[model samples]
Target: MLPADGSGPTLAIRAVAAADLAALLDSLPPAAATFARASGFEAAAGSHLVVPEASGGIGSVLFGLGKGSDAASPFLIGKLSTLLPAGDYRFESGVADETLAALAWALGAYRFRRYKRGGEGGDGPVARLKLGPTVDRARLESQIAAITGVRDLVNTPANDLGPAELAAAAAEMAGSAGASFRVLAGDDLAAGFPLIQAVGQGSDRAPRLIDLVWGDPDHPKVTLVGKGVCFDTGGLDIKPDTNMLLMKKDMGGAANVLGLARMIVDARLPVRLRVLIPAVENAISGRAFRPSDVFPSRKGLTVEIGNTDAEGRLVLADALALADEEAPDLIVDMATLTGAARVALGPDVPPFYTDDDGFAAELAAASAAVHDPLWRLPLWMPYAPMLESKIADTNNIGSGGFAGSIIAALFLKKFVERARTWVHLDIYAWNPSPKPGRPDGGEAQGIRALFAAIEKRYAGA
Candidate 1:
C-alpha cells in the first residue's frame, strides 16, 4: 500500500456551504469572524479561509462546499492540502461524503519535480490528513500512489524515458512485487514482434518487449498489454510541430497498465498476472518504416501500413497476439491509439471496445462505481471491411475518416483469438488543465474501475 506522512499538527476543519456561510461564521468566535471578514472571504466552491486565533496563532480552516443544490464534485475538496499551509489537518465535523473529500485531499498532494531545478517545490507541504471511518486510508493511499505513478511516467520527457528506460521502470516495479521480469530488445525482439520492430527501427533506442509475471501459476490468468510508444514522431510520416509536442505522452497506455499492476500486486490479488509492454520510440530516420509498407505480425497476419502515424496499434497487435497465445482468462489492452477517439468522445471520457457482453457490463458497473467512466463504442462489423488490404491480410488503418477509432479497435481485434475475454481501451491519458484532484499533464484513465472489476471477478479464484 502507498505510504502517507502522518506526522504533522492536526488543525480542525469546518466545511461550509455558500448559503450557510453567515450562520456558520456567526457561530465562530468574534475574532475568527473578524478575520474572515477582513480576508473578504466568500464561501465560493473550492474556496477556503484559515481563521486566526486570539493570540495571533493559527486557527481552524473554513472550507467552502459551494451551493447546497448543485451536485458536489468528488474532488472539490482536493485543494485543502497544497492551498493550506503545510501541516497535518483533520476534519472537525463529519460530512455526508467523507470518502470523496479525503481522497481528493490526498490526490492533490501530488508533485512532479523530476526536471525541476534543485530547490523548486522543495518547501511544498507534505500534506497529511487524519480521516475517520468514512474513508479507508490505506486503500485510498494505494490508489493515490498508483495514479501518481501513471502521471509521473507520462509527464517525463522522451529524452529520459525512451524504450529501454520505460522497460527498466516496469522491471523495477515488477522486481519489488517479486514478479519475474523479462525483456527482448534489439535483434531479439525481431523474431517475435515484427511489427514492434518495424515501427521502432527508426530510433537509436532499441525497441523492447517487457514481460512481467506474478502469482501462482495455477491461478486464473490475467494479461495486460500496453502500447509503449515512448515518443511518436509518426516515423517517415512525421507529425506537425504542435502535434509532436505532446507525443511524449503517447506511452500513457503503458504507464497506466503499470499503475494498475501496482494496485493488484500490492493488494495480493488471487490471480496469475502477466504484463506486456512493447516499449519503443517511433522516430524519423533514413530507415524509418514508411506508409504502404507491410509487416508480418506475431499472429502471422500481414498488416499493410496505411499511415505510419497509426503506429500504436501495430505494436499492440503483436503484443496482444502473444497474450492470446497464452489463452489467458482475461486480456485487456490499452493504448493512446487514435485522435478520432478524442474527436468523438473528447479527452476525459475514453471509448472502449469489447465483444463479450458479460465483461462489458462488468466494466460499465465498475466504471460507474469508481467514477472513472468509459463509453462503449460499437465494434460494428460493417466497419470491418474498412480495414481491407489489396495484397495483405489487413490494413493498419481504415479506408478513410468516420469511425476511425472503431476501425482501429477492429484492426487490433484481428490479432487475438484465444483469450477467454478481451477488452480494449482507447485513452487520452493527458489532462488539459488542472481540475480538483486531477492536475494538468498525465492522468490515469479507467484503471480504477478496471481494477475494481478485476478484483471482484477473481475474488475467490
Candidate 2:
C-alpha cells in the first residue's frame, strides 16, 4: 500500500511539542541543526520541517503537535501523507501510540480519485509510510478499508450512487463477508414498507429495503438502520440551490452503517449483526408524495407529511420499525435528519439521543477515548407533543421551529417500541471544510465511537 517511489531516501518522523522545540533542535546532529536553521524551521504548533542528513540527502520530518494530540486523534499526523517527500518514512523512536499514528497515516493517504484524473495529486512525489514493528498492521488496514468504504460511498455522485447502486454496494460488502443479504423492492416495498415506497416513488428507480445479517443466530442481536436518501431534492418541498448542493451525501448514514458493520464483522464481534437500509431518492415528480399526505408505516403509525422535505425520517422510520420488531439487544439508527443538529453540534460533532443512561455513558466514554466526539441530547417528553398531527397519528415534522432535532428524534422514537435500547443519531454527515484526516466532503461521524462502545459491551461474550 506504500504509494511512494522506492528509489527515494526514507526519513524518520519526530513529533515535537511546542515547549520541547529548543531541546529537540539541540539534540539533533550538527548537520541536521544547520539544515533546520538554514531552512527557517520554526517549531510552532501545527508546524513541520524537513532536516537534511550529513550525506547531503533528506533526513527526517519534525512535526509540532502543540500539546501532544491524544492517541485517539489520528489526525495530528494526517497532514504528512501529502506534505512529505515521495518516499517511505517511519517514526524516529518507538511510539507509545503507534497504532493510532499508523491509522492516521493510512487515513491521511486517502484520495477520492474516481472522477479526478491523475489520481490524488501531490506537490512533489506522493509520500509513503514504512510500517514499524510497533504498528498494528491488521487494525490499521481494517480501519482504512472501512473508512475508505464510507468516504467513497458518500463521495460518489447521486447519479452513480442511486438507491439501486447503494443496495448493490451493500450486497457486495455482505457477499465479501459471507453474510446473508436480502432486498425488498417495488411491490414488496409498497406492501411491507409503505413509507419507504412513498418517499422513493418520486424517483425513476425503485426504492428498496436492503437487509444484511451476519454472525451466529445465538449471539446477542445488534441491529443498525440507516437513512439512504441518495439525492434529497426536498420532494415536492424543493430546496434552494445552496441547500441542495451536497444532497448526494444524504445517504452518508447508510454508508457509515456499512462501514461500522465491516469493522464488526472483520473483528468477529460476538453480537449478531443486522443492517437495514431504506435506500431511496426524495426526488421531484408528478407522483411525488406531497405535504399533508398521511401514510401508514411499517409500525402501523399513520404519519402525516408536515413537509415533504422531512422525508429522511419517513424512510428511517420504516427501517427502524422493522429493526425494533426483532427486539435487538441494541438498535442504532443514523440519518442526515435535520439541520438543527448541525446548528447545535456543528458538523464535527453529532448529537445522539437515547433514554438509556448506561448506553449513553458507554458511548460518551468511547467517543472521548477515540476522539470521535458525540454529544447526548434528550428526547424531552414535553416537546414530544410538537409532532402531533390534526388528522394522522403524528406529523413527520414538528410545527414549531424550536427543538427541531429533538422533535425529529421524537418522531422516530414512536416507531420503535420493542427494542430494549434504541439510540437515534441526527447526523450532518458533510464536512464543510478540510481538516487533518477528514477531507472537505462526506464524513463518517460517530461510527468509530459507536463501534468502540459496542465492542466494549460485547467483547468477551
Candidate 3:
C-alpha cells in the first residue's frame, strides 16, 4: 500500500486447523492454537492461514491480525516476502483495516535495488500477496499514493532533488490543491529575503523561498516553514564521507513538511494554510557563504555564520521571520538541523522545542496516540547565550558543543516572536531500520502527530 515496492510473498492463506499442524493435530482445532504460535508475528484480527494438502506440504501461509496497533506494524507484513516460499499466493480472510494491511504488505516487499538493478535482495524467492474482500479500494489507493510520494521523494538523489527541483515539486503540490504559489529566486531572493539569499549564495543553484497559500483568507492562519537544503555538502565546512552518505536526506524536513501539507490539503482542513520552503544547496564553492560573514535577514536581524554547516537555521530564520510577520495563529518549522539533536534524543525520537506548554502537551499526547512518536525537549532559555555573536545580533552555531540541539532551537526562537503558538521540531525523519508501518529510509515522522493534534484542536471548532 504505502511503500509499494512490488515485492511480497505469494501464498494461499486460510485459517489453520488443529490437524494441520505437526503437534496439535489431534488435541485442538486449527484456529485456536495457530494464532498463539505466531502471535509474535502480529496477525491482524480476522486474518487466517492456509493449510496445504497433506502430501504436497503446507504450501500456503496464514494471516491473523492481532489487536489494532495504530499504524505501527505496517512493515511487519514485509517479512512475508522473506518467509513465504517461492510461489504465487492469494488471500483468504479479509481484514477490516485493509489500508494498513496493504501498506504493510508493500513495505514488507521493499528492497533497495539501486546498486544491482537486477540483483535479488536475498536468496528468498519473490512472493506476491493478493487482496481479499474486506478492503476499501478507493481509500487504499489514496493512502498508497501519499506514502509512495514520500518514499520517492526520499529515495531520489540530492543532485536530482536540488533547490530548483524542490520548488517544482512544491509547485506541483500547490497545483493539486488549486492553491496560489510563487517563488522568490536569484536576485529577487536578495531583494526581498536577504537571509535566504545569503545562505543560498554559496551554491550554483540560486536559493529561493517557496510560498504556497490556500483556503479562505478569513480562516485561522496556520504557517509551516521547512528547511530545504536539498543537498548539504556542509558548505565551506564539509562533513566527512560517512556523514555525507545519508546527506541525501538533508531535505527530509522539507519532504516531511510537504507530506504534512499533502495530508492537510487532502483532508480539506478549514484553516488558511501557508507552506514556506527556503530551498538552497549547501555546497563548497568560491561563491559559497563563509563563516563569520554577517548577513541581513528578512526581519532585518543581522546573523553571523559561526559555522557554514549551520546553514539550516539561517534559511529557516528568514522564512520563519516571514511567517511571523503574518502573526499566524500557529507557526511550525521542521528541520534536520543538528546532529546533536539526533545524538541527544537518538534517531527514533524527535525533540520538539516550544515555549507553549499546552501546545507541547497536546503534541506529545497526539504523537503517542497515533504511534507517530516524539519527545519534548525544553527551550531552555539559559542556553541562549551560546548563540551570542560579538559582531551580529546572533551566531548560527553554538559556542559549546554540548546542548547543541537546545542552542539551535534558541537561535530559531529569536526570529519567531509573532505567532501565538509556535513549535520547532528537529527530526531525523529517517528510520535506520524497519519498524511495522515505517520503512528503513525516509519517514513521515511527526506529520501524523501534528495532524492528530491539529485535528483534535479543531474538531469541535
Candidate 4:
C-alpha cells in the first residue's frame, strides 16, 4: 500500500481574480513568465507564474482551476498531474475546497503499474500540498483508502487475481478488522452452492463462496452480495477478442463490495455486516456449464441456463438466496451483470433497482451528496414474466435482449424475498475515459451512495 500521508505545503488557493493578474505576472521570474505566456497562463484550468529565487531556483507556483459554477461540481485539480513537472506542487488559486483538491491530488498521483515492464520511476517525490484549514482529515483518509482499493484490485490481471486470490484479499481485510471469514470450496460448494459450483467447475482453480461477518450480531443485519467472476470468457457464448481484452475487470462488483465493506467496518456503522461473494472464473473448458443446462441453487430453485454468458446472475442468485435466508434488514447486491445497463447508463454511472421506497430515497440522497453517481430504475413488475421457464423456475436470460438489465434484476429479485429491503446495482465498473478523481479502468461505482445510505439509516439508533 502506498503511504497515503496527508501532508503538503501551504498553497494560496483562490478563484482567479482579474485584478490580481498583473501582480501575479510581476511576481514571476523572466523564464517562468515567458513559459507562462507561451502556455496561455491566464487561462482558466491552467496554471501560471513560478516565483523564483535570485539564484534561479524555483520557489512557489501559481495555478488556475476556474470559478465554481455549480456547488456540487468538483473544481478538479487532477489536471495538474499531467501539466506539472515531477517536483512537489500545489494549487495557488481556485475554489479552496481542500478535501476535494486533496482527493484529486491523490487520484492524479495514481499510476496503474501492474502490467508495465518497469516499476514506477524510482521513488519520485510526491507533489504535496497542505490541505486548507477546512480539511476533514478522517473523511479524506477514508475515501482515499476506498478508492485506492478499487484501483489496485481492478488494475491487476485475472491471472493474478483469480478466485483464490480474491478470497485471500477479503480474508486479509477480515483479519485486520476482527471479522470472521468463511470460505466454502470444492465438495462443500458443490453441495451447498450448486450454481456457483456449476459456473466455476470448468476452471482448474476451484469455485468458492466468500462469507465475511462483522459488527455485533444484536445489531440490525445488513448483507452485501457481489458477483465475483474473476474473468468472463462469456463461457460457451464466447465474447470477441476486443470484448475480452479488459475482462480482468469483470470482478469489479466483488471489488466494490469489498471497498464498501472497508468503509462500513472502518467507520463502525451501527449494523451487523455480512458480505457474500461467489468467486469464480467463467473460463472455456470441456466441462464448462453449457447453455440449456439447469442447475439447483442454494434457494432450491432450478434455473435453466438460457445463455452461458449470463452466468453472473446464476452465481448471484445462490448468494442472494443465502443472504435472504438470514432475513437481514437489508440485502444489496452489486454486479457487472448486464450490457443493457451499460447501454442505458453508459460507463461512468450505474443503475440501481429496489422495491423499497424508503431505501430508494436514501440511496438517491446519498448519490447526490457523495457524488458517487447512481440512478434508480423501476422493478417494473410487468417484466417479471420474461424470466419464466417451462421446465424450471426461471431462465437466466430472457427471450430477447430488450430490457436485459431489468430482467436480470428481476431474476435475482426472485431469489431474495425474505429480506426487509433488497436493492441491486447493475454497474459497469470501468471508466471509459479518465476524469478528475476517477481514472480509467476498474473503478468502484456505488459504494459512496451505499455507505451514506447505511450510515444515515443506522446512525444514533
Give me the candidate number with maximum TM-score.
Answer: 2
> Candidate 2 — number of clashing residue pairs?
0
- Show where candidate 3 strays beyond 4 Å: 1-60, 63-78, 81-102, 110-143
**Model 2: per-residue lDDT, tens digit, 249-357?**
9999999999999999988899899999999999898989999999999999999998999999999989998998878999999899999998897888899999899
* Model 4, span 354-458: residue lDDT tens: 999999999999998776789999888898888889999889988866899899999999898889999999998888888766777778889988998999998
lDDT of each structure? 0.87, 0.86, 0.75, 0.81
Task: Report the C-alpha displacement of residue 47, candidate 2, in angstroms.
Answer: 1.5
TM-scores for all predictions: 0.93, 0.95, 0.82, 0.90
* Candidate 3: tens digits of C-alpha lDDT, residues 142-246: 444555566667767887899999999999999999999999896788887887787788788888899999988988899988888888888888888899888
* Candidates in order: C-alpha RMSD to true structure: 2.4, 2.5, 5.5, 3.3
In model 1, which residue pairs have backbone atoms overlapping below 3 Å?
Answer: none
By lDDT, the best candidate is 1
What TM-score does prediction 3 earn? Answer: 0.82
lDDT of 3 at 375: 93
User: Which of the two, 1 or 3, has more TM-score?
Assistant: 1
User: Model 4 residue 193 lDDT?
Assistant: 91
Which residues of candidate 4, in runs, are more than 4 Å off? 1-11, 15-39, 46-60, 66-72, 86-93, 117-123
